[model samples]
Target: SMGNQILGGGGFGTRLMSEVREKRGLSYGVYSGFTPMQARGPFMINLQTRAEMSEGTLKLVQDVLADYLKTGPTEKELDDAKRELSGSFPLSTASNADIVGQLGAIGFYNLPLSHLEDFMQQSQNLTVEQVRAALNKHLSTDKMVIVSAGPTVPQKPLPAPTDKPAEQPLGV
Candidate 1:
């Protein structure tokens, strides 16, 4: 999740481009994204790199995350983000299906009807300090789970098997 917060195609893409791809040549592309549900949902970072560079790529991801957390978005960037968010919200309610889905979300999540009503206002009200604080608090490199799927073997051996007996014998 921390990887996602730091590597996804959203605001964090710039860091991935600079640190991992350009500086280290670790990946062809790297991106991070977040989908906040009723509570904090998954933040995901994805990348494409040569199999040999996987470990180094992962390390670079961590380094990039550390840098990003310490230095959040600039004031102009924050203003642009708020503007984009506010501008795009109307499109989220454009179609009947969209409206129904939003309403369903509100009901499912027990959100008040005023939630949608207040969205734009709330987004407008968000301060740069708030965003920076949120980034510092939530996007920590120390609290992360890394999952890699590739041809390269892991540096460490796999964990020992559980002692519980199998339901059916192997090769049955």
Candidate 2:
């Protein structure tokens, strides 16, 4: 989940946002998520771009994902993800509805009474290698399903991912 956050978990600083939208302007938005349920759940990456840019955008997203899987998140990314998750933890119980939802999920999922705090502590203690290994264990670009809904139009190829040394994600 931490790896997902660093890669594409619906934030302005995520890799997908930084690469696919902010850097190259291929799509207005791009995000990925992992939904862990009591049973099977889905991991999804979604984006929307102009019809003509569909194929190119897909390729770009795939390439970015592939590269991310190969290299994993950087130290800075890991720190940022941890910080973000920790900062948001308190909100999970700030409202009655939120607290009820959390409690319900704990009961429904057969989680421990201290599941929330346990999960938060575990998340905070996770090493970068552990996060990367967990992500790699479950995700593969080749196994992903690509679903697009829009007109099919010819378009120029999108630029490939690059090795720019600056802080910002570039190209793809």
Candidate 3:
């Protein structure tokens, strides 16, 4: 479930920026990312655009999510994602802070020291179908909460289908 949400949410953001901003000239430099924590976290869309484009940009993000849920990533897209992730993994681990943080995480989670070593191999083995399956299980745009802070924030109506779905009733 977490995997599904991450991929879908990331893909949705990428699709939104490319289609709504770059192609249609609605915004400049739109991006999205998700943080799936041990319990719950946040998915955010960051965009830079004029005040006039805010509503349209929001609509575009919603549309992107809907479309992504209906049709997940293709094999090529999935492969590209894996390649990018694998390629970037080394760079991310290059920092001392990264190493310490990872070590700390292993300790916190009671994972074996070998967890770090196995990470890359595991990531490489992830297939597109696996990522898509994860995305399908995790991403629920309806459960997402929206928050914004800035002058000239648009008064656009929030995307329809407004009822917030109950979270998976977190259990101890």
Candidate 4:
């Protein structure tokens, strides 16, 4: 599940996190996500690290995205991402404050009132083909905008993971 992969608005993990943090010690935290809106919201990636690592970190992140675009997510990866989204749906809105927050977003977006009720079912139904098709259709690496802010020090390329054994998550 993503609980181990990437840290986004949620800490569900992905390939980006695996490469940027788990493999290389480029940054302390890194995440990327998309918010589909009436038009197109944003495909944003966020990272935090010491000022000196910024240049290398940014370059590495781009490399990650390029690799992903070259080969979209595998079936297992898609399943894991969807599973995390569906399984955590309830816990995500377990609190009253969370409920209100969700409701506010729904209302502001003019989404159906039944959105939450059907979220899990919809998420679980997503197929790898669908995810891949969507990515191929919407994302183009050549056109992506890169924004970097931090130190300008020359940094070395990150080292590859030595023994990326499957990690055992310790807590929720």
Candidate 5:
């Protein structure tokens, strides 16, 4: 989970956002995450871009993932992610409703009473190699299921602008 968060679950700081959205402007938003389930959950990376740019954008994201797998987060990135997560830890149960929700998840998952605190501490203590190893074990760019939705017709280049009016003023 921390690995996914570092990769793309966080907002602008994530690798996906940094590479696909901020750096290249290829996408308005890009994120990746996984949901826990009784069985193995599905991990997903999602983004939206112009149909004309879809292929390139997907290739770029794939390359980013590949590179990340080869070389995991830096020490600074790990520190930043740990801080962000730790800073937000209190808010996870700031309200009664939040507490109930968290408790429900804990119960449903058969987690210990101290699961939340344990998770926070564990996340803070995780090393870069551990995060990379966990991701490398579970994720593969080659096995991804790529899905695209949009105009199927080939896009045409925009017509060049004309200096003259459609009907010139009374034969100029």
Candidate 6:
């Protein structure tokens, strides 16, 4: 879910991007992350829009978060998130720098030596219910902390797009 917020499915495109940007014209970007920790770490979601749209964008963000928390994730969403992680995982291990970082975390945190292996194994086996449950348990909107800085503007409806799509591009 966090990954979807950040990079979308496999980073090809994202739901949040679609909802907040493409559909609603709210913000340029929004992102989230889930990092390993000895106990619990952070799950963050963030975005930015025009000064006038900040409040509306924030509301939309809260709405999105509320929907996510309430319903958890659909099976397709769950599968997509897992696929994205697994497909890109090789990059996380593709370099000595990456290996060193992985090892450093394991050592620094006193994590099991098989942490990497265990992580892959566990991730592959997680069900949609499990992912949804885990995220709901930890990533609650009730517990979220929001801080915003922007100019205040009277709320207004998004300007309807009046331009029609071109039949073909100039080059094409």
Measured by TM-score, the strongest candidate is 2
Please provide, for model 2 over 1-172, each residue's C-alpha lDDT reduced to its tens digit, 9 standing for 90 to 100. 8899999994788999887776667766788998888886889998878776678788788988998898898998998888998899899899999999999999989999989879988998888789888888999887898788987677876644444424333333
For residues 1-172, what per-residue lDDT tens digits would candidate 3 score against the true structure? 2233233334433566556544455554566666646665666666655565566666777777767666776666656666666777788669899888888878876788898788777876776666666666766778877665556754543222212223211110
Which 10-residue span in candidate 1 carries the lowest summed lDDT? 163-172
Q: What is the lDDT of residue 50 in candidate 2?
A: 74
Prediction 3 global C-alpha lDDT? 0.60
Top of the candidates by lDDT:
2
Stronger candidate by TM-score (5 vs 6): 5
Instruction: Report lDDT (CA) for all predictions.
Output: 0.64, 0.82, 0.60, 0.65, 0.80, 0.65
RMSD of 5: 9.1
Candidate 4: which stretches are off by over 4 Å? Answer: 1-12, 35-38, 50-53, 164-172
Candidate 2 ranges with C-alpha deviation above 4 Å: 159-172
Candidate 5 residues lying further than 4 Å off, grouped into runs, are: 153-172
Instruction: State the local distance difference test value for candidate 1.
Output: 0.64
- The TM-scores, one per candidate, come to 0.70, 0.88, 0.70, 0.75, 0.86, 0.80
Tell me the tens digit of each residue's lDDT in model 5 across 20-111: 66656666679999878866788999988777666767777798899889898888889999999889989999999999999999998889
Candidate 6 lDDT, 13-53, residue by residue in tens: 56566566665555555766666677888766667777666
The per-residue C-alpha lDDT of model 2 at residue 160 equals 48
**Order of the predicted models by lDDT, top scorer first:** 2, 5, 6, 4, 1, 3
